[model samples]
Target: MAAIALSVSTVKPLGDRVFIKVSESEEKTTGGIFLPDSAKEKPQVGEIVAVGPGKRHDNGTIHTIDVAIGDKVLYSKYAGTDIKLGTEEYVLLSEKDILAIVS
Candidate 1:
């Protein structure tokens, strides 16, 4: 897919969604073996780059999302839409897909 460059100043999520800057996959192992681009495992942890306004409940209230910008989070490995902006990679996924906030 064509990569659309997103800047914090230019992009915003409309609901309980988040935009994450994906941590790079490891290039080399502790055993000193370098993996090819096609062989590396996808990283599930990343820093939240941007977040949406809270999700609105049916009772007419909004519950604030637990995550905020700069929070490092763990997500399901198969979750999120992969996107590339310039040379950097990012993931766009719902707040529910975020499994935990990493310290």
Candidate 2:
């Protein structure tokens, strides 16, 4: 058996997929109450880390994705596959899973 090292730079999303680094969840409530780790919600916001070329159209043309790397976006709550690299968290999802680009 062989061992391969996977790093963030080596990850590339294929075909309309986007790789995002998840943002940290809120540690406290708006009311100034501290929340435990288990009570923290999975954040829907993330920054785009890697993106695929684009989706192929019926005519063989590529329909480019709207978001770009470094763009902060909001995605579906349970949309993408969760990934953990070292101590950071990421998600790989289709373009459709993204709801909007945050300013």
Best by TM-score: 2
In terms of lDDT, the poorest run of 10 residues in model 1 is 4-13
Per-residue C-alpha lDDT of model 2 across residues 24-43, encoded as one tens digit per residue: 99999999999999999999
Q: Rate the local accuracy (lDDT) of all candidates.
A: 0.89, 0.97
Model 1 C-alpha RMSD vs. true structure (Å) is: 2.8
Once superposed on the true structure, which residue ranges of model 1 sit more than 4 Å away at CA?
A: 1-5
Per-residue lDDT of candidate 1, residues 6-96 (tens digit)? 6655778878989999998899999999999999999999999889998999998988889999999999999978887778888899999
Lowest-scoring 10 consecutive residues by lDDT in candidate 2? 1-10
Flag clash pairs in model 1. Answer: none
- What C-alpha lDDT, on a 0 to 100 scale, does residue 96 get in candidate 2? 99
Give the C-alpha miss distance for residue 15 in model 2, angstroms: 0.1
What value does the lDDT take at residue 43 in candidate 1? 98
